[model samples]
Target: MKKMSTDNKLISLLRQSYGTSNPQEAATFLSSAIGRVLKMEKEARRAHITEALKGVDLRRDAGGGMNSKPKTVYKDTKATQEKLAKLEATLQEMKAKYHALLNDGPQTAEENTRLKNRIAELQKSIENQKSQHFQELALLRQHSSNVANASELAALQQQLEDFQELSTQLSDECEQHKTRLKTLEATLEDKTAQVARLKKVMAEVAAGDEANETNVHQLELELANAQEALAVARKQNEEYNDKLLATLDSHLAANHEIDELNAKLVAALDFGQVFADEADHWKNAHDQKYADYEELQRRAEQTQTEVQSKYVDEHQRYKAASRKIDSIIEEKDGLHRQITHVRSLLKFEEQKSSDLTRQLSAARLEMTSMTDDLAQEKRVSELYAKNIRELHDQLALLKNRPVLPDWLFSGSMASGICFGLLFSFSADVAPAQRVLLGVCSGAVAFTVARIITKKNHQ
Candidate 1:
């Protein structure tokens, strides 16, 4: 009944004092109550022992046990007492030994002072050695400085020598350059003179070409006049030959008629003696007409032969001229082929130029894209810089905030409050959203509390 009453009292006390909402606090309160009850019980048992000892019937019990040796109660009690005394003595000795061990450092104050003095002496000796070492280091540094100065001086001297050598080389180079300049200048003058000479030669050649062209023009005009005169002469010759052949054929026809007339007259005179003389005269006329006809035929044959020869000569000249014109046409065709090849080359070059232009445009586009990317990168870097600055300001503000008390953030109180808030939010929010907000709030609160506590401590 007492244990049950004590347990109920402990529960009531815990509920009233610490709010039993937190199990850990309730457990702590209960444990403290149990410790208090156990302590009170121990005091009550000691009080009972005192009262019982005062009213004990030691004599009666000894008399009753005397006949049968009383079951050796006193001996047992004495033995127990002795064992307890020995145990107590051993405990006291162990306590004393422990205290001695605990206080076993330096017993005498003077000895402690002497040890402190010795330590002080050692410290002083160490300090003196350190000072000596520092002094030696300073001396060594001075020696090293001297050596460094010597080395630096040597290096400077070497550099000076190198500078002098470089100066000499430069002077030599300058002299050579001056000589080369003079030589180049002379050569330039010569080349200039040669160029002038070439220009003069070109001018002379141009003059000669102009003169030759004028001469060729005059020759062409003369050739045209000669061709016109030859045409007129040929036409006149053909007209004269046609007129002469017509006249010769008419004379032959007239002579043949006269011969026929003379033959008829002779035959008429022979038929009468009185007309004999007239017959002879007619015969003579007939013979004369025959000779005239023979001459006319021979002249016609010579004229025909001359006309054939002239035609043959004119045909040979025309053939030669035609061959020359054909050769000129062949040359013109070759030039046309060369022109066509040149046109094809020009077209190819135009296509290549267009391709190059396209490539250039593509390269320009790529360059523009790269430039835009670089600009974007620069903007991002600027944004990052701004973010860093903002973060720095926020951190400073956090550092200046006030701290929360330990009791407020202790596991039981904070965990209970956090779980309650999480449950309440979870009812209104989605699971993922609740978790995210809970984690963010928890992290922010913890960080702010830490920063505030640190600031307050400082």
Candidate 2:
């Protein structure tokens, strides 16, 4: 009875499973139930056989006693009959169920045909789904690749911006350098002008020195001639004085001898008056020459003083300008060193930027490759799903069972559901396609749900 109850429970389970009208589900359920029943039956049979063997052994040990022989034989026969009857009944029940299931042959055939059609349609749909999934994967990969490319592009653009900024700064620096150079050149020109002026001054000083030398020489010659003239005048005056003295002595002797000498004395007084006037004129001329020589010497001293002052001023200015020039040269040298340092920094920056660009490029390439692999995997998964569906259909046909009903097939619904799942699961999709799929699926589900609700309300 317990075995019968268990069989009934299994049958009930089979019926319930079949009622769901899903062939694969039914197959799976039925196969499991069948396996369980077979196992249980085998275990029961094994136990029963073992008991029968033990009974035979006991009968043989009783050594042909009538009671032992009849009891053991009857028990063994009865157990065999019961087991056979139970097996036969179970077989008959299974046959009746199989017959009942086959009674709707035309309907089952039609359902099967429809199921095959639906399966084919579903397979095609699934294939399309797979293709769409592949495309979506490809689109996702493309988006990922594009994102990587955009990142690289942004980096490159940033580098370019940096380069441009550096270039602008360099240009500004160059302008400043040019201005500085011009200023230095102007300073050099001023220095040159100053040098030229100093040279002119020195030339004037030289000319003045030459003039002073000539004046000194001329003055020396004039002094010598004046001294000679003074000596000759003194000599002439001495000789004349000597001759007058002699004439006075002779006149004195003649006066003593002759008292009539008064007329001759008056004539000697007139000649002495003419000689005194000439001597006074010569003394005034000699004093005027001495004053002229003193005036020339004073003028020469003033000229020398003026020349000395000019030389001192010029020397100071030249020294100051030279210092300034040295400072400018030092500044220029410092600027050159700064430029060299800046150039080295720029070179290092350029190398770093180049390395960054290369790394970005490599990363983008890797992303593209990964995306392609993902797309391929999606395609393979789709193919596998299609194959499973085909095999399922073939298996249903082989089992001589009705395929699932159209209402339970769920091809279109499953496709839409899968699309939704895929859309939700993955974030990589083309904008246009994603939007279109979302809208279409949403509309379909909404329409179906609304129709069902309206029908239910009615």
Candidate 3:
């Protein structure tokens, strides 16, 4: 009866929480919850009774420095939480790097402006050099025309000697510049190799991160499953606690009923004892009052038969009551065994819940680690992207920059120079004609070299 009242109160609370106008649905939910709650409580009581009876050993692990299983689980759970915190910290660092990568756009824009300025400066310098060379050529041509005065002729000769010396020095520098170009080419090759290695590493890291992401997702699903199981176990445990209370109430009520029955049986036995005593007194009184011996003896026999029959019925009734009590005791014993079995099952479930919770924590740690790794991979990939962009920009700038050192065009220019030298040395040709041919060939070679360079760049 008390259990029924408790169920009613619980149902009322649930109905309030449900807050539904449809009472029918609420009643249905109430019925289900009551049944579930009752079942859980009953199971839990049985389990506790089993533990009290020492029917099942809860500790499967006896190789123990630990006092109990729960303490060990607590220690492990605490350790896992600490590791999870560390993983979270690492993940935060990775997030910071990702943000940094996102902020690099402004820096790339600044680099573009710098490259543009450098290009403009190179163009201005090339124009200035061209104008200065043309002015010097004009002055040298005028000087070559007038050399009638000895002093002026001597000065002109000295100027020509200085120009020749400058040409020889420039050739020697060009030879040295060619050797430097070879070394620079080797260094550029090494840099390209390094860049290729970096690209390979980035690709591998990205692939590994992708794999870890998939693994973490699987772990998340498993963790969710474990959590659901744990919730179910907790609900069952609550139901068991409720059932234990209800069973204890029922047992107490049964004990009270047995006590009442025992009291009534004792009262009935006392009344039977008093009635037997009265019958004995009546026999003694009848004997003394009887005058005729034969008549008195017959009356006594008849009373004796009646008294014996009544006593036999009372004995049978007492035996039946005692048997019924014995049956109740046996039933109670059966209940105790069932309770013990339930306790074993409860312990098993508790162990399962603990293991599942531990696995869930481990999965969470793995997921956090995977997330951090993925972030790091993303940051690295972004860095690679930036480096690639800068490299492309540098390559474009190098291609467009003004050509340097006349020897850069030596292939075509050498052909022209050779033709000019051959024409200057020819016995059949006029000096002016040879000079004009040489100049035209030189112009042709320069044009051809420029065209080839442009085509190569394109």
Best by TM-score: 1
**Model 2, stretches more than 4 Å misplaced?**
1-290, 391-458
How well is each residue in 181-290 modelled by candidate 3, as lDDT tens digits?
55555555555555555555556655655655565565556555555655555565556545555655655665565556556556656888765555555545444443
lDDT of 2 at 341: 56
Which pairs in model 2 have colliding backbones?
none
Which regions in candidate 1 have their CA more than 4 angstroms from the true location? 1-138, 163-187, 272-458
lDDT of each: 0.56, 0.53, 0.54
User: Best lDDT goes to which candidate?
Assistant: 1
Better by TM-score, candidate 3 or 1: 1
Error of 3 at 176 (Å): 4.0
Error of 2 at 91 (Å): 46
Q: Mind sharing the TM-score for model 2?
A: 0.25
Report the poorest 10 consecutive residues by lDDT, candidate 2: 65-74
lDDT (C-alpha) at residue 128 in model 3:
60
Candidate 3 local lDDT, residue 243: 54
lDDT by residue (1-458, candidate 1, tens digit) is: 99657655654544432433344454566576556456556775464334434533333333433243212112457789999999999999988976765565434667646754664465456446655665677567666755765565555555555555555555555555555555555555555555555555556655655665565565555555556655755775686578567767777677777767666776676577777777777777777777866776677667666665665666555555556556545654654565565556556555555555555555555555555555555555556556555555655554464433344333332344355446745586533343345445544665565577657667
